[model samples]
Target: MLGTASPTRAWLLVEEPGPWGAGGVPESRLGPEVTESLRRTASALSARLLLVRRPGQAREDDGVRTLFRVTCTRGRERVLVRTCAAADVAAAAADDDGWTERPGNLLLVCTHGRKDWCCALRGRPVAQALAALAPDDVWECSHLGGDRFAASVLTLPTGWTYGRVDATDAVDLVAATAAGRVLPALARGRCSEAMVAQAADVHARLALGVDDVAALRPVAARRDGEDEALWHVDLADAPASAAPGGVLRVTVRRTAGSEAALLTCGAAQEQHPPAWDLVALVARQLPAG
Candidate 1:
């Protein structure tokens, strides 16, 4: 699941403390017209609409809802919150007022069972584990893609999505994020970046032994003109005492999996998802200033 993270730079998480259908928001109790309007708003903002709730069976509608808009625009990451009724939540997407800026990060664990059985089976325990550590920061979110990679966790403001996470390591993962470091082993990719950039970023992080989430940023990515399988990506490194102006270049090849299989529980047929392989990695020094 290296480069399989969903590609979305912005996210609109609506607090819907109730059951979610296989289709998530559309199937939730948000009503048909409201759901469509929310979908349009999300599409207009290039954001994903995720239904989120506090962990467990405390599903009583209190006539109040919290809406969060998180933007993972690389260096300009930020989270905005708005409190409004469920009926008026969609209007908050484009509205410029009444939004409070929030700091730190948000942990979203997929527990939308209707979407896929694996999610409910594996995601809930992980969510419980994480919420135990950071009650205010953790949420049971709707489908996060890659159902086969259940127990998927996404950290907001940075858009770092993790896959195949276990309940035992949930605290470690959240602690790592709080400390501004990344657990590379379970990372799927950052939702804000393209697939090639995601693959390259992970490869660069591993190759350089850098775990800090802010240590490297994707500077450029391009596909080979002659070969669709080849991609070239460059990452800009943050200033450091050892290497002030450093850049890392990564080359990756995209190929199909050796065998097709069921990627999600809801799928009726099997297919092969694209796989990214690291070809080469090189670190270069910038010319003297």
Candidate 2:
């Protein structure tokens, strides 16, 4: 079984020119001290740390020129900073209000073998395939959690996370994403929203046949019971004739499996994790008075 998809709030990318080995991104490239500092900073900021590099030939240089990108969905911000060492990332992570509002997108394929074998075994091929399709936009990033869902992908700027992806699905995923559509079957959820909102977004997308990435936005979310939540979402930029002020209410219930299993390979067995189930969906169109 695959790992459950969850939402994330932000992403932190660090550029490292590499000839990445089977072990994944070489921490040796970043040096021991800088590596430690980067890990600490990323954890403190609750950011997913990724290693990125421009596709193609490796440049001959003794020192690495790193570029750091911080992506936040709260204000729709993407900030980029250039530095000579990985240790410098701390300062950028420390800044709370320095992100620039812009549209920046990247395809991050997790291949962190040290963290989990499935990631390297299942993720590398997908990354290579995607790179062939969009060289400038694809990258082999570090762990993005959910090792059980190896070959997990995070589409940036929009922060849509997908799991259990394979090489065969790379082309269609890229095409759909480029056309501003979300693939519900493979989609985990957007990192920008909460868990219930993520589930609601998926349900709404499938119900309305709405594909645009930014078409639906969460208006409100609230708990209705100990294990159930309701979400109100608005359909943005819809045709007036189709939906006069389109809105949807989605109900999601939290459920648990009867068995315990390892969340990821090499991890101890644990109680079943909570899973969300879509119970009902209601669409409303306000009268244009």
Candidate 3:
């Protein structure tokens, strides 16, 4: 449960009304060929493939109205394909003309039971709780890469991933999303950046106490050594109280996990997962204006 699940850079979501099996989307109604193809496509793009269902009764002609939504930092792409066929998915995911720059937000809760029981048990309640608060903005989504972090939450349009969340955390999460801030305590990382960058972003957020989602943006990164990296983050449109010429330098290194355990309950005990630790944090002061 201590492993980082923040490596994804993009996400491909397919609408599937189910009866999803124990393995979730992979074993869902979408045939094995299409599922496998999706897995490969996602891997090629460093993205995560997920199955999503809008809240309500399962559609009778689910396959005919399947929706494919691709979200990346560059833009949000969507297409409505008539079938759950693999070829269609490939074309849609690859189609550049279909992508558009639009501002929208969505809360995706991981409730993929087939991937791990904990996700379903822990995530469903949180999803329901959040959905009650923002009915149109929330959806029960498939595996989000962290089975150990059962109640994993992904905030889209920004792709901020949070894990180990509970029903009680819904209010804060919703508020944070609406206000363009992130809760550092549960934040796994931002999907758009590398793990090192993700750590650096969190460090900067804590040091500056800047919660506005658009406040800090990674401008550059450099390697300090094999295990460490320095990230240059620029603060945009910061409040006057934030200080002059806003910029923050964050250094992060890989650290040891507190202990080793299977990342998921269903996984064999032989598997070990690494924990996230902050190695260093420093604020770079700017010259007076």
Pick the TM-score winner: 1
> What lDDT, from 0 to 1, does candidate 2 have?
0.68
What TM-score does each of the candidates earn? 0.92, 0.77, 0.77
Write candidate 3's Cα lDDT for 82-135 as tens digits: 334433765555454555443456889988887788888898889888888888
lDDT of 1 by residue, 1-289 (tens): 7888999999988887876886855387777777787788788878999989998667668888989889998888999998897778767756878999999999999999988889989999999999889989999998888998898999998999999999999878989989988888888999999988988888777766778888678888889899989999877874364245677778999999767978887789999977899998766677689
Report residue 107 deviation for candidate 1 (angstroms): 0.6
What total of clashing residue pairs does each candidate reach? 0, 1, 2
| Per-candidate local distance difference test | 0.86, 0.68, 0.68
Candidate 3 segments whose C-alpha is farther than 4 A from its true place: 1-3, 22-25, 36-47, 55-66, 74-103, 225-243, 268-272, 285-289
> How does candidate 1 score on lDDT?
0.86
When 2 and 3 are scored with TM-score, the better candidate is 3
Q: What lDDT is reached at residue 277 by model 2?
A: 68
109-131 per-residue lDDT for model 2 (tens digits): 88777678788789888988888
> Residue 45 of model 1: what lDDT?
76
